[model samples]
Target: MLNKKVLSCAFEKTINIEWHKGQFTTNNFLHILIHELGHIFYFYDWETFKINHIFYLKQFLGHKINNLNKFSELDKEKVLKIFANSNYGLSDDDELLAEGFAYWLLTKQSMQTKIWEFWNEYFTSYLPQIRDKERKEV
Candidate 1:
């Protein structure tokens, strides 16, 4: 089996926005940043996540990902839907999670409580290291 820590995730960092009245704002960019941060949060915590919560993640996601390459399109989507909050998030599992987390952080209300708890644990446990790492780099 592929190691969960070796699996990849993609994310956006910066975005370009057109300036217009009553349109997008810095808050929109903050949401995108929050989504990207969720991906980083997972990246930095992959080992612990795999060791402790892989089964829960798979179960909560509602599809077996061990053979993702062989999944039928419909089957793939069934799993992805649990994390995707928008059509844009339907690309794959990672986006589903990132986008779903963005919505979760903003609303704080959803049926995705399992994922929320996972993220909460991740952040609770890792925030200190993350802050220290960035602080040292600065």
Candidate 2:
């Protein structure tokens, strides 16, 4: 069985500590892990090792990089910069695909703690703004 305390502690170590406090349950952690794992599985299918490796290299070299398990608000800013400069914002196709895949994976299982609900809300708010910039660039 999953431990709510341990899961909440892990969440606290990340960016959403205060905001997500008392918000996440054990089931929430399972959903998050499964969501991330979905992204990993998708990348494998999409032959994204090249770009993913580059991303990891930049991360290891101390560049501000955000992967599924490790996204901070700063990474969100970087994505905004990418949206300002490129069609996809700062997110590459792989990242976008991963996000979608995560949502899909969440649907394949029972969701607890309303984590999927929060994720959907976040995507609904952010994706359009990013996409609006892309549309204007066209």
Candidate 3:
């Protein structure tokens, strides 16, 4: 062991230093990975993906998004800008499905619990393929 203390951690493409303190967590990373795999599932199942997308799009656009995550304060203006500006999610059917899948996986929602149920069932049926795809993609 050296005299100097450990300064940072790196996991795959994500680097964590003092600057990124509290910005994310292990659960968040898994959620994001799950989100991307959700996109792949959407590609395989277009009809169900479309239905979920339209439903969530209406739900989110109809009201202000208040509790999307834990790290940020809620604000309609900022959230809308983020929805419009993000590279993925919030702007299209596929992205919406992916984000919704991740949200459901991460947070156990009681209301409209069907979304989580659907993914859970879907993943159960396709576990091996899902794990393989996620490993390759990330």
Candidate 4:
């Protein structure tokens, strides 16, 4: 059976805005929306993502010093910046990707940082292909 998932957002209530430092601004809403879209994007091609990206990300953050050692200094710095952008992302690889995606789309500083290169690559290369495939199916 195909499973269905729901993503709910209540913009009117203060409770929904609390996690965003208690402000209900358009920027905050955009961040939340983009972050959730990132999750949807991940789930859309989960098998490919799990094999290509998640495995390496898990190893880099996992409990082994040797795994961390395998990454270059630049790569490590980029990963740290991703976590720094949103501490919530530290919970897991999926959050990391979502947070990175939000930061890449919403923050001006993100353009200068290599931290969001993965998102750039995905958007420029994979997104068009995904769109084209959907168009053909329809």
Candidate 5:
């Protein structure tokens, strides 16, 4: 049984990790947890995050454009390479961020590209500042 209020709160900065015994390996569990945390980070400053990463949003959306013939073959290849690490990221902007976050943390490697640089900075620097500011407000 799930509580509707709690479920609603989940969209409002609440993160609840439901653990199902033997359902996931340790690696999968950590990946999922980090991915969910990425969602919370995005929710913290939705507009700013979206604005700051518009290039990525556009590139991710390019996957769809490729199907419509609006994107060139080179651009499509670039988009494919960018999202090769996580196909799920091709789904949408939010999923792209979350999947990238999980991949970055799990691999413990810097992507060194412009979009990933922003993502890394968001999780490492911006998000902490936001949290600190909120703590002061409370």
Candidate 6:
């Protein structure tokens, strides 16, 4: 029964990516940052530490191989899919963690963020395997 604000506080403790105003408006770009922040909080949650380590390793290597911006939608989806679908991905845990955090931000009046209309379309495609009941319930 953790409140969204409580989850947000827990999530912010680990990830420190500064929000870039310019990128904030972009669809997948924002989700990318949110997803990485999820990993930070996932590590905070103490579930799958070594696997999260490997997830980052694969992300680093994938970025190196693709030479794409880490924030790029394609690049980010690659990382999210790999992390959320691998042994770590099996739980659908990361998606819930990330979406929970993002959902909090979306709900807070001070956050000044709209529910970017296209996010669902884009994220749903990347999240083919994981289902987010909370998102629907919200």
TM per prediction: 0.44, 0.32, 0.36, 0.50, 0.43, 0.27
Candidate 1: stretches off by over 4 Å: 1-27, 47-55, 61-79, 108-138
- Alpha-carbon local distance difference test for all models: 0.51, 0.43, 0.48, 0.56, 0.55, 0.44
Sort the candidates on TM-score, descending order. Answer: 4, 1, 5, 3, 2, 6
What is residue 100's positional error in candidate 3, in angstroms? 0.4
Off by over 4 Å in 4: 1-9, 12-27, 47-52, 56-84, 109-111, 122-138
Tell me the lDDT of candidate 2.
0.43
lDDT of 5 at 86: 50
Evaluate model 6: give its TM-score.
0.27
Q: Rank the candidates by lDDT, best first.
A: 4, 5, 1, 3, 6, 2
Top candidate by lDDT: 4
Candidate 3: segments with Cα more than 4 A from true spot = 1-27, 47-87, 109-138
| Number of colliding residue pairs in model 4 | 0
Question: Compared with the true structure, what per-residue lDDT tens digits does model 5 show for residues 1-138?
Answer: 757565556533322232223222222545777888877766665544333343434444454343634757566546644743454565566666777777667664553666555456656776566556656765
Alpha-carbon error at 88 in model 4, in Å?
1.0
Q: Candidate 1 has what TM-score?
A: 0.44
Residue lDDT tens for model 3, 7-80: 21234235333115532223244665677797887776444323343433334533433455433433433443
Candidate 5 stretches with Cα past 4 Å from truth are: 1-27, 47-52, 56-77, 109-138
Specify the highest-TM-score model's number: 4
lDDT of 1 by residue, 22-137 (tens): 12222255576677886765555454333222333444344324676466767755664655555556655555556655766765465557656655544455444554565565
Runs in model 6 deviating more than 4 A are: 1-26, 47-91, 108-138
| RMSD, every candidate, angstroms | 13.5, 14.0, 12.0, 9.2, 10.7, 12.9
lDDT of 4 by residue, 66-132 (tens): 4766778666656554443555666566776777677667768635565455556555665556556
